[model samples]
Target: MNKVPITVITGMIGAGKTKISNRLIHGIKGSNCKVQVLVYYPDTITVVEDISTKRQYRKLPHQEQPAKLITTQEQLISEMISYSKEKQPIDELIIELAAGIPPQFFVEELFQSLEKDMLDKTFYIQSIVSVIDAQHFWFDYTSNHYVIYTNDNDRMEHTFAEVMISQIEFCSHIVINKCNFISKESLDETVSFIKKLQPKAQIIFSADGQVASQTFHSVNDVDLHQIKSNIGWKLELKNNSSTLNLVEKFGINSFIYESHSPIQLEKLEEWFRTFPSEILRSAGYLRTYSEAHGLELLYFSQVGASVIIETVDEHCTDTTARSKVVFFGFDLKDVEVTQQLNQCLMENNNINQTVV
Candidate 1:
């Protein structure tokens, strides 16, 4: 049986992991390689559309980003591969995990369960990757997130920063996203900080979550248990230090604001012009009332003090007609931010009930 290479992508909630997954698979679509992509979101593993295929994308409403749910990992690796004697072959596979789930969980599980000769010989891990949000690295991560866990060994309180850095430490590659949003000097410091944590991992800077074709070929084995056995918190403390001081000294935090109400694009943009300076990054898909553009939804994202909103409904834009923007940084009172965002919402009677 020919071995199928698997690449595991993991990171924080908004670390560009999904975008990178789309790009990696899209880049390999036309190649001779036969590959399958599996994205493990919070609840289910979905087989997404081949965003590279224009025809498939055009079929979507407003040609918005195409996303499809897939069968579970058990189906692909065990049920399908175990019958390899009768099944057709798959050359490569990519698995993107849900936020907060570590990559090592899948790695250790596969090795333990795939011991049967059929799967043992056929399935192989290709690479592990973690995406980092460059602009928020300094002001959002650290403090209570890791400090709480460092003091108490409770995974329940594990911070996004802790989970994110662990993903980076265990992976073969680290992709620092939104590099263009920060100054070159700050980017250098971010890279240096990541280097101190994962010295051997390959670190790539990405302006928009795109990487070279060669990044997909790297396969590095990380011994998560071995690290746990030796040094332990001594090394783990470094991970906390990387982003802890920033959050502690700066006194900032992040949370997502999701509203099903359609927003007037013009009003939203106008508001962003004078939006609170505390917002480190705000990204989400929203509906626009403008009939001239014929666009039902638009994507808005602000990194640090800069906003990058696009009208294009390509695969890169994952925002829905409803908005779910993330606000990260300091001096943002929940009530004030919520009130300000509410003001940007459209006054129309139309309602999107997809919200909780």
Candidate 2:
């Protein structure tokens, strides 16, 4: 039918999610579709008067920030309703979620909360797409830390890693941007990483934030119940997206990997090199059995094709005595990953078993 297709763009903070949103907006200008955007803007960050001023790669028509960032769920629904009721028809609705919030919530809860007939008649979810930062995201993956700050997470309690991983786990398509900084070998490694994590998700490599025209095509409908966890919407009954509610469905499941003993560097790298494809993302801290060169802890975060490891100082507030990691993906076997990781732990500790 002729329902409006809504596309959501999500990713880690400063991961170029906004730039992708802008590209989509400008890309649809002359396509004969009436499109409107509702972007999330937290109160703390300074709002740019013209969000598109910096997008100078191509000549875009009058693209500007539609409204200040949307804060409350109520506001999001209210504004979207207004768009549907407007005199000029809007065939497409594009939403850009702030880094802290998961786009899964708005697409699942917001639509489900509204009258079924109203949503089916007016709006259908086109797709949920995530943008990843090539450099910073790699750093987050390797350093085992995401720069998601308190100001962003205040709206929700999800950690930066949780926020980023959820995006990778749930989205139908993943856009890895800012590839200019990495070498060809690193880029190949990055692609290999993502392919393992989400073999099903369409991977798009973009130097800039722009996607090819084909990626913007719309989907017919969004059936929540029948669709299952294809979009990683676990425990939709809850108002928020929490990993505690994660379940196995649509080929995806998550488990925590914890070890008391430190991991051997060579073994850990080997495990990473042989990471399972069914696993989409792994983020956590890795501790070496013995402190070396004043370094004891390494932060690790990997999504699909990117793996990042950041060295942690001894004085850091986070402990480096043990390795704690979280794994999320489709068709994953908890036993398999744990067993491989167990081989990486200090062989002498006698604590070879990893808690999953």
Candidate 3:
């Protein structure tokens, strides 16, 4: 039996994954391929239009089908299995994972199912495409704000940088959408940064989400292990490198900051409020002192204008209390950032001296 190729579309919030999915549906229909889209949304309400009805209303040829809304993992898997068993199976399946929900989770699930022989032989993942917002990519990528998703009576939280980076790192293809909103120089820089992060992925720029159908059709099968371990940060961390040397190409640079002492809460807050614009992205773990919780281990994240310092949980058990953060930006001043962060450390009252 011929396997139905599945393409997963994902990106940060407002990056136009839905628009791209719709465009792909239209493009696939034009190519005379039967396609089905499954939209996994955190909320019950969805905006994926009934493209078939709209095409019929306009009397267009090869009317497309509507997208299915999926809210849980069980439902998504069941839907795919059912679709594969249909009398006239779809030529392609496009699963658009809503913004905020990491695409890795779904991709991992699909791989696990395939390994356990739970999925029909007629289904295979064709590509994992991440859509990026050209204009707001830097802003959204650097912000330290948390993305909260409530689904199936469970709440999940992840920093914007974490989610965005994961999406970029795990994908086989990247679509830089909304290119018209940014300058050519900015777009070039954005593309450069994405390449730095995911050098293996095929990248294409789009005015909106109008990518050629061939882009989707040309993708080769993704290697799950390579995609999982190829994250820029992971490579940098594994190499034990303190700095990246791309400052001349596009002024893109990165550095790792490490400290053993606890950060004073007041000073940390002050530092966050005055975070340098030069540092576009930073993420790691830190130890901080709070009046209510004394010495606590926390996760630190910063992207653009947003910053988040929150308690670490079981998921971060491997992370130590010692602070270690990876900072990425354009022409980052490692010394200046180091000094500022050092000043946020607690003072040793016993020795009447400040700890750095």
Q: Pick the candidate with the highest TM-score.
A: 3
Q: Backbone collision count in every prediction?
A: 4, 18, 5
**What does the lDDT come to for candidate 2?**
0.63
- Candidate 1: segments with Cα more than 4 A from true spot: 42-76, 79-88, 116-118, 143-155, 218-356
Model 2 weakest lDDT span, ten residues long: 233-242
- Report the Cα lDDT for candidate 1: 0.58
Give the higher-TM-score candidate: 1 or 2: 2
What would the per-residue lDDT of candidate 3 be over residues 1-356, giving only the tens digit for each residue? 67778888998667877778778888888988888888788563233222332211222233146678898777887787777776757788898887776788778887787656566467778789999988777666545456666557876666667678778878889999989988888888888777767777888889977887778774345777788667665566556567555644689888888887877778877888888888766777887765567666888766566677888878666556477788888888888998999998886572234322
Candidate 2 segments exceeding 4 Å error:
42-68, 143-157, 222-356
Which clashing pairs does model 1 show?
Answer: 46-70, 47-69, 47-70, 285-319
lDDT of 1 by residue, 138-215 (tens): 544532322121113432334445455567557777899989989987787666556545556777889877876568
164-255: candidate 2 lDDT, tens digit per residue: 66677666778989888788766766665554344456788888777754585766654444333443322221123223323423454566
Q: How much RMSD separates candidate 2 from the native structure?
A: 12.4
> How does each model score on lDDT?
0.58, 0.63, 0.75
C-alpha TM-score for every candidate: 0.52, 0.57, 0.72
